[model samples]
Target: MPYAKLTITVPDAVWIGELSRAYPETRFRVLAATADVATGVARIEITGEEPEAISEDIRDYDTVTDLTVFESDERMRRVQVETTVPLLMTSLQNSGVPLEMPFEVCDGEMAFEATIPQQNLSKFGETLDGMGISYRVDRIQQDVESDPLLTDRQEWLLDEAIERGYYDTPRRTTLVDLADELDIAKSTCSEILHRAEERVLKDYMGDEKGARPTVAVSSD
Candidate 1:
């Protein structure tokens, strides 16, 4: 089936644009986001550089009508922000796209990947247009489901490493640090990360015969 990965630049009304404007230096990753239609509120888990700083910054936005901090660590946080604005997540759902998890928010943009039907691509576009939302199609291609990418254990290691900031530009954490956290050998951690990265690249690129077109779609 054909799939598309979208990197959408949301409006200032949403949390991504709002928090990015407030705290440009810190990175923000949305671990989970759900729009409760009945309540007319979006409950989101925003993970970012300083929990306390973000908490203080959030108070400035009237759009975020409610806030709750579920957990925090030195590197990142998992807090719930209830907002009144119509969210990009909601927009995607309204479009009927099957979104992938662990989307991110940074520099006023939200990145999401979804497996959408080839015929429904236009439907998705029309849905976004109807919602009056602007977005960009980062990648759209035919997915190779037959080929398995990473093993469950490798995926776990990669997810953990990412959460620990091992992939940060300056390298917030090291392989040694990750190993210590997981109580495993440094060599083991390195092996898993390397292998996982390889699989991710392979999957992203796809096989030569199965490679599909990649177009940059933007409302601008």
Candidate 2:
């Protein structure tokens, strides 16, 4: 038997059914999958061998789209924590606070800035007791990442626009309206938006080289 990996970008609603039928007797693994309701983009990865043949006792699949080969060294893996600030806050409140001090999560691996006095740290640490969370206030500021999309000029523009009430939650103005306000053409504005989006993904996600799947024909 020969193996292949299929990186299928399709609708999540139909993926499970298709997968079951496609590899009925074959042992397979779902390496990764992402379903975003907002974008309706579902990225799925599955790897398995051909337990049954689809051609004249030859190649595993008759169509090329059904196969994607990968080198042995290629891999995908990561570690992540899933929790929101609101949930964390609710958990915190459920624990108990010894004082009335304002603080922020700072949203990074290490370090934080404190407007409140340093004494508040121990009190907060005590509050974190039953919550199973660890936190601290540090005097040093560390390096962190900004959005991958924003250039200095682009970030400056977004900040200024937000400050000027351009893209409010209530939808103040359209992109064309903002373009006119910035004295740039609509097409130029669209181009900037496209470039900025692509740059952010490329910079942050890294350029993922496409894997070409393998096909094998075998006969006893």
**Candidate number achieving the greatest TM-score relative to the actual structure:** 1
Candidate 1 residue pairs that clash = none
How close is every model to the real structure, measured as TM-score? Answer: 0.59, 0.24
Residue-level lDDT of model 2, residues 48-83, one tens digit each, is: 343223111212222212333332222321111111
Give the per-residue Cα lDDT of candidate 1 at 10.
69
**Alpha carbon RMSD to native, model 1:** 12.7
Question: How many clashes in each candidate?
Answer: 0, 3
Worst 10-residue lDDT window for candidate 2 reads 1-10
Root-mean-square deviation per candidate: 12.7, 23.5
Residue 119 of model 1: what lDDT? 65
Model 1 regions lying over 4 Å from their true place:
38-49, 147-220
Give lDDT per model, in order: 0.73, 0.39
